[model samples]
Target: MLNTNETRIKYFFILGFPGILPEYYGPVSALLFLFYLAITMGNIFVLVFVKCERSLQKQTYYIFCHLALTDLLFGTVTLPKAISKYWFNDSIISFYSCLVQMFFVHLIGAAHSFILMVMALDRCIAICIPLRYNSLFSNKTVSVLCGISWLVPTMFMVAIMYEILRVPFCNSNIIVQCYCDHMSISNLGCDHVREVKIVALVLAMISLLLPLGFIILSFFVIIAVVLRISSIRGCIKTLSTCTPQLIITCLYYLPRCFYYLANFVGYSFSVPVQIVIVMLYSHIPAAVNPLIYCMQTKDIKEKLKKKLFSWKIDSTTKPMQDKTWQ
Candidate 1:
């Protein structure tokens, strides 16, 4: 416990998966290390491909690149510290460092939510208002949309962080989850935090529900528009574009909604179970998004195949070149 006048603490101990036995730390750390590596590499591939490939320079792929950026930042912000906690026993994070982590975690997440809504809006326009999509969502317009996606969430998150900082945290300096977040950290403050909690809940709903509602409505419009098309092939082609977005959306939101509901229901879930649920919603989406959105595309798959074949040929010829030199 901190002294009464000591409103702030310097470090907060992050306890990741309290249920893990001492002997299991090695395996868990190794697994998380691999997980982080795969997610970062995959998102990087998507980001580079989008930027380098001429064919993928449209607004749609631009949104994909931003999504990749968000996923990469999110994974970097949340996972590395948790891995260190288990692997290197570096669980103590500075107070400001934890706050920075919390900011980016929520910022990237809210940005992704807004981006998904923008993607859905793009799809709706492409399908429902096909004639105007190119006009309505020009490069400048897309840039503005992307700017809004990043900015609005940041403003909200900054406000949340400010409120959290204003409250003195004289209580335990231990965070119950894998990362520092508004809810987890704010809950630890020794002050009367009922109003803080309520405000946090409202901010959460605004950050999540507003964009979510727009996404749902946009998809409904998209499906309705797609259903009206007379050509079966056209309908199939249009629906194919939406499949990845739908999958990514479900992967991102469903588990999150369930986790929130579980908490609200006051179910006595173990700490490990709660952390596992959080990991499922947050980590899995970032890890799998590149595969779903990029690799699943026929163009990207063909490009990858050609690259692999060329690499194999180079490797095969390298040995011959060495023999000749000998």
Candidate 2:
């Protein structure tokens, strides 16, 4: 029988930066607010620009837009509460609300992993088997892959959330991390902690490693195909196309894998260091992914330059036209 009286954790108090002194809170909050703003505006611009511009309506761009959307959701779900926690000292999140946040954090993250894998696959087909790239990755096929990226993660996260909900929380309500994640929340459960942790870990590995494996394989194949090109100019052109995706992939996966491995091995860092690593893996990619694409991809860079030039012309000309009319 369950003891109703013992299960009294109605809310969780998130300790965003337990080690930082009060004087630094404002600065930290300001920095986080900037990151949130950058992530929101950057991803929104990518999504909107891709939707409005027909020239960007290709298989690779479609996957890029999906990645942008995933980054937007991930940042929106986690950053606001963290900003509130530092800015106003408001860290109390209702138990169910924490669960909801945890669910979306993992859901969007898994979706991102899968989307990146799809991007790698797209590149692989384009580079390794150039003749059939269009036929292999048509609009319908891209849509189906993107749909699976989202839908499969949704089902997995739903199951993980169900398992988390069943864990009885009768202990401390303080979450040592910035936001409520699976491991952070499950650690507070009174019982079945090991089982819940194992289940969550297994699901997390499936979401991360499976996609990572495919991405590695795809990149290896791409490299091999690129190597067979005899011309120096051909090699440079082919490798340049993949550089941005490669950078973003490294930024997203490396820190996360390091953190997980450290935790799995029972190695601990100071609170501030740990928090920095977490934020690096979580927020940096979202804030910079669009910028990387805009700067690195020739089509996106040219289109963005054109859009900016037109906007400047309109702003300058509208004032002159109004004055002349008056």
Candidate 3:
């Protein structure tokens, strides 16, 4: 319980979720551990698939690769500690460590937003204006966009972190969410937090809303182009390509929308409910994004099927080979 009056705050005790019965902690911990496991394995599959299969190395998948990487990074940064908090009751984090965690949590989130926006643009180019897809989305161009996705968020979050660092936290050290975040950390600071709030609002706009707006605009144009295609097959094909992106977008954005709007509208949710919603949006994408791509994308699915079939063949033939050798 370091006070602001003292030299400086030393640590933060992260209260993973504010409310749960003693009986529920084990179940909750088990569930979150499972979530972390799923997220890790799913994202790894996508990453390995992208790396191993040359056919999956298209510009669009370059964006998907970044998205998968971001999700993996996001989950890795934010989840294990939270899982530890729930399972082992190791909730204390040093102040600076908390800051670092906050940085990556937001950094990766903003990067994911930008990546999704880039994917929308790729989808639009591929589906709406097929001729220019090659010209507009070359590997070099996608690489540049990927760099921007990482760089812009880093810049924005750095600014936000600077502002956060300036806030004096002399109050109680419990963060109400499952992890340390900008809002939770800043709220614990002593003094007027108007500046932090302003910065957060701006960051949210730049990182979340701006990308979402661009995605919406892209979707509208894509729908218009898709409508013009006379053949049902062409329309279905175009729509199918866009569907996974849309699903991923919705998972990432919709919960954020509800949370942000609830706060803005002064709607009060129970702490447990809020925590549940926040945790779902924060980590579920890590699991869902890769699963969606693996199942929905034709190329990735084909590659995965071939790999699985090869594994099955190897497993069945391994015993026969051993017997023959004997």
Candidate 4:
């Protein structure tokens, strides 16, 4: 039984790796880089393809474009630094660097969460009141939603930053995990993380569970509507459109749901499992989104064709064809 007087283990001792297995720094670092290369290149290609392709400039997919951008930002904020620490086993981030890292991480994370919410809302409005979907999710409305999705997360991250800055450092300054995570930074604080945690819980409810609840409700409604459609073709088309979004949402949220559940429920998963879980939380959102949007979208494909064709040159070393932006 932990004593009431025992301060909740102020300042976690980040004793170096437990070293259960051999450290393959070389292979791990290489693998991490390869993953980044794939994610970064793929996402960049998707975004540029979408933007350059004029046919893609529509409401729902426009929402998806911004979603892709935010996901890119999310991956950018966490993985590079994490990859740095993982291969190096070096935990010497300056306090200021840690603070910035912490801020951007939460910023991107909150943005990703909220953007998913926006997507659900867009789908909901489109399905629930198709008559007014154009009016409801108009250029202005979507623009506002996208702007808020980026801005609110910035504010939320600032709050977490304040909480983290209040901590009193103890013995060791090393972070045990791949990067400077939320809990790891929170652990740096001394007593009185109570208020911060409550705020955290509330923000999380807004960010994750609240949106998830809305999405679930909206999906059920969407499903009910599809069932009532007189034509099977209508039903199938609706299902097809929803499928990619559903898959991407589940992939992005399920791991995070499990990671938190594991933390709250008390489990004995090994460090490697935990590490993989964390990596999934950071990477999969970025990775799967482009794959989902691009494969499902024909307009984007055409734009890619146009852009690639104009940008490619003849083998005879002639100049490239002129490109026209739609």
Candidate 5:
């Protein structure tokens, strides 16, 4: 219903936390900044520790490294802008920049889902068919799987972005979300809005549901395999290895599934509540994944302990050496 003379919007305003009071912005931004720091440092440590330690170079660790990289990229893409928006009251983003952010958000998110599916598959094969685990998931195979994770999502999102580009934006330029994404940006378009929404919803459902389904199925198989073990100690030991992945998988997928399902059913929450849910699912998993891995994975835990002990030793000895020199 918009006239052709209505000026095309050049930039968009992100109205993050729609009902939040001005006084609370600093505290919220500080919390977000802390999450950004945790995500950055933890994932970086995982990547570096895995890379430098030759003993950690294996199929499972390779998948973990890929996950760390994906999580780091996810936090980098989404968090800083939200942080700046709150800290500086800078919510304006140029149209193209928003599109670029949307593209990367979907791309990386899809890649992450696929990567998780790969992780589930990896665990499934390791547990179900231990004899051929290495042969099944070789270095080349992992590289191909990870490459496909990134590549397929890139191609899919590029197509979506192309469709998004064709839509004209001449109406409201305010996005009621912390960041730009397919839904938030597409909703601003004045033409083909419903069609775009339908297409986006369908694609999102496919992208999210497919991997989620696979993960669920994989876990079921893993549980069955674990239950079949005759000895209680062996079963407990096997289940412990899977516990971290299960925790992270639930953290990453469950909230997102709920949000998407709610959207599909046309049930809506308050704007602030919706944004909070999105942030909880998107940010918390990345921030917590490294901690879960470090605390649960025996190899990483031992290495971290050793590294910290060495640092502690150096810290105490350095002051003693300085006093002796004096």
Candidate 6:
């Protein structure tokens, strides 16, 4: 028998419910849509700019593009659906779509963490092993690393998707956190959730904790290496090269750790708190990445600026060139 008050079941799928009430949901919905659009466009620009610039063919820039792509997929998988729910005031997610949503959210979430870990390792290599770093993390090597990073999450996501399909959603349909979360869906399960929770907890710890520890350790080694270097100019150049990457790593990891902390403590926060966390690490990271590279790398900014102003100068000189030719 069906249990949820807001939705009806037609055998396998439970119709989704209307979104939040109009008294407050309207403005909040507007804000979410605008932010998602901004994040997508901003990250696309970063990826495009990086790919087009020949000077950015180094390992660091290659990893930066991968991070930007992860951020874009991360933002896209959930934000658009959240906007739809708010616009129609309907929160009813179908059984299959909800499963797909959770799969992608976790997939991109895992990829984002792995790519950051790779970036940290890249920084370590460039700083600690300058000469061999190029051959070590060349285009082919980086591509293979990125491929494995993406595929690891995909394998787990496929397993989870298979498990989710077997369970029946006879109890609830509304997901509270603006997007589908695994634990929230597990809470509505028709069977014992112990195995699910245990698997999820283990995966979460691995995905979150392992990379975090590596980053801290890498930085510790990085700092020591920098201190031992005799030349100040060489040290400054190395440190400057890594500043943008470190800023992005902090932006992604810091708030994600907080969100996991909240989940661990069994604390109940309002919906807005969840949204804030997504903004702090998840959505905001996508936009900040492009800006970070722009500000940190003067050559990139000069290239962008030249592209921007070239149109105007070309427009002004077109007629003059024609007259000179005559």
Q: Pick the candidate with the highest lDDT.
A: 2
After superposition, which runs of candidate 2 have C-alpha atoms over 4 Å from their true positions?
1-5, 262-267, 312-326
Instruction: Pull out the clashing pairs in model 4.
Output: 167-189
Which pairs clash in the backbone of model 2? none
Q: Candidate 1, residues 71-156: lDDT per residue as tens digits?
A: 99998999999999989888899999999999899889989998888888887888888899899988778789999999998898
State the C-alpha lDDT per candidate: 0.85, 0.90, 0.87, 0.70, 0.88, 0.75
List where candidate 6 sits over 4 angstroms from the true fold: 1-24, 262-268, 319-326
Error of 1 at 316 (Å): 6.7
Q: Considering summed lDDT, which 10 consecutive residues are worst modelled in model 3?
A: 1-10
TM-scores of the models, in the given order?
0.91, 0.93, 0.94, 0.83, 0.92, 0.87
Tens-digit per-residue lDDT, 217-259, candidate 3: 9999999988999999988987998888899999999988988
The weakest ten consecutive residues by lDDT in model 4 span 1-10
Q: Against the true structure, whose TM-score is highest?
A: 3
Better of 1 and 6 by TM-score: 1
How many clashing residue pairs are found in candidate 3?
1
User: Cα deviation in Å at residue 217, candidate 2?
Assistant: 0.8
Tell me the spans in candidate 1 whose CA falls farther than 4 Å from its real position. 1-5, 265-268, 309-326
Q: Which stretches of candidate 3 lie over 4 Å from their true place?
A: 2-7, 318-326
* Candidate 2 lDDT by residue in tens digits, 1-326: 21233665788889887778889989989999999999999999999988999999999889999999999999999999999988998989998899999999999999999989999988899898889999999978999999999999999988888788788888778888999999789988987788888888888889899999999999989889899999999999999999888988998999988887898899988878887788878999999999998998889999989999999999999999999999
Predict model 3's lDDT versus the native. 0.87
| Candidate 6, number of clashes | 8
